[model samples]
Target: MPTSVSDRTGYWDRYAEGRSDHQASREEALKGAFGWTQYPGHGPGDEILGHPATTLELGCGRGDAVAALAARGVAATGLDLSPVHYARARERWRDLPCAQFVHGDAMDYLTQTDKEWDAVYSIWGAVWFTDPGELLPRVHDRLAPGGRLVFAHAPAVPGAYGVQGMYGGGFTGRQVWIYRWAYEPDTWSSILADHGFTDIHARVEPAPEPGLLGTLIVQSRKSRPHRMDDLTSSKV
Candidate 1:
């Protein structure tokens, strides 16, 4: 796996090229899927997001889900590390006025942006690739009060926790690799709670077919502090 940002960007650019023909159509993109299950519309849908007015998607590959949310009247922005994916997304969904795509690293964007989002999510995206310990706090800080954080990715292989390296793309003989984080559902819940999140829900959903890997889905909300007026009124 490449350690530098520029190298990682090149890796994803090649990966995108290998899968260029796999882009979803406009109608199919409107109905998004959160997991890699073979079954259509399987697992949780966007309803778990709770009708957010604005959303930011970390590692929004191809920007299908971002476009989907925008179609539902949410102002959605997708940030990706792969320039190829970003360009493709912009050209494909340019008609959607509410949807936007930006090419950049997730951590850098999160650290620099002053804007807060009603909800932030990733689908087999940056939340998987980036270090949660470093990434979660930044995500929490950028969320509005009671904002949501949701993500879905494949469960870790047995005994494989934290950063795991794997090869990607269709390259033969060349070892093009990438790094991802993997944790059990319980560990994921604990990590979110420790990061000051409330209402944490993390679970593994079975794949549509037997012998296939299951998807790990996690959802949590930023805790809203109690107001003085509400406390005083409750005392009366």
Candidate 2:
């Protein structure tokens, strides 16, 4: 039980290029490994986040989704904490002018960047690693009006922290205790409401086995002032 989980870069760094190892082409990797084909922005660029929209992927490992978005004419930036992951992403999409990759802490990047985005998405990325209190507001601030946020998260397994349900594996072979806040379904909705996100929805996709909780596909739109008021009234 390694208690030192403050830094995850080293762990992810060694596993950065694992996506490339599994699938021959980037498109195949995105579909097989990431399930990008089933995401919101998979159709014509304009139908989802809007064509030529500015987008950001938090904890973007190898920048597969970012590269896909850029290919669809979106201005996409992939922020990753692992230098190896960042370098891999940069190299993968170097020729695409619309794609960019940055290596740094996700919260630090969000707090410092002045750029606003039309949409921000993550696929089991930093949203899990970071505290929701610190991460959500920064994300809300960075998204432009009408901006969308979506992420796929697995339901937290039943167990006490550090004792059970801890998952990790890499070259180091050290089993570090995973740090994740396991809250109920409504708790996620409450957090989003508090952060001024409207039209919040969570779809539970069934898990592979019975009796196991499924994945939560959460989606929300940045609420306008009027929408916020409406949400408040509806809650009361």
Candidate 3:
């Protein structure tokens, strides 16, 4: 069955049609502003993201990366689950010819949308879904054969995700994947491998500034059709 955007809209407020008025409602999609601080110099994550890259940001909130990418000559689009957030993104990067803002589920959009991209990425956003694993293959199909997927997720280390113990009170963090069952570094790696993504690479990046949580950036590329080892490391 084709992915339906409403399946997600129905769950989160301001995501469905009726939530239009709620855009001005109290409590924004994100409790705080996005874009705390960007990494300095080229790191391993940027190595895989590529230079002058055409990127699809899965949950591009407020367009920080979008604006930055546009400035760097990277063709980028921002897709998000919040119309409120997307509206802000649209207004912020209105003059950017190469940057587009979209209101939709990342997986559903990737699976059903008419466009294909050179890369797919995300920050700490809507990745905590009930079946986020299914998103990998859809990303695989939408990429340009050797395209890559890079994202920063919540740390998988213990004492994180509010778990009380190792397995931690049946915590298992949270159900970001319906079939995959949990959210962890291993879980993400295995999911990517199962979906035919190779050269998997990941690391936890602590924020340079405060008032934000750290992130784990995972970069993977398509294994077939061609090889671009140097191209994979391109970044602005």
Q: Clashes in each model (backbone N, CA, C under 3 Å)?
A: 0, 0, 6
lDDT of all predictions = 0.86, 0.72, 0.62
Q: Could you tell which candidate, 1 or 3, scores higher by lDDT?
A: 1
* Residue lDDT tens for model 2, 1-236: 44236446766776675545523577664553334223433212223343438888888887777877777678889899989888878987798889999999878999999999988877778887777877899999999888988776666554432122345673476764455555555677888899889888766666556675566667788965567778899999
Which scores greater on TM-score, model 2 or model 3?
Answer: 2
lDDT at 48, model 1: 85
Query: How much is the lDDT of residue 139 in candidate 1?
Result: 99
Which candidate gets the maximum lDDT versus the true structure? 1
Q: Which stretches of candidate 1 lie above 4 Å from their native place?
A: 1-6, 21-24, 32-39, 168-176, 233-236
Instruction: Report the C-alpha displacement of residue 186, candidate 2, in angstroms.
Output: 1.7
What tens digits encode model 1's per-residue C-alpha lDDT throughout 3-75? 5333688888887888854466677666653343335578778888888999999988888888878887899
Consecutive 10-residue window with the lowest summed lDDT within model 3: 161-170
Q: Give per-model TM-scores.
A: 0.90, 0.77, 0.65
Best of the two (1, 2) by lDDT: 1
Q: Point out where model 2 deviates above 4 Å.
A: 1-4, 17-23, 30-52, 158-178, 207-213, 225-236
Residue 68's C-alpha lDDT in candidate 1? 79
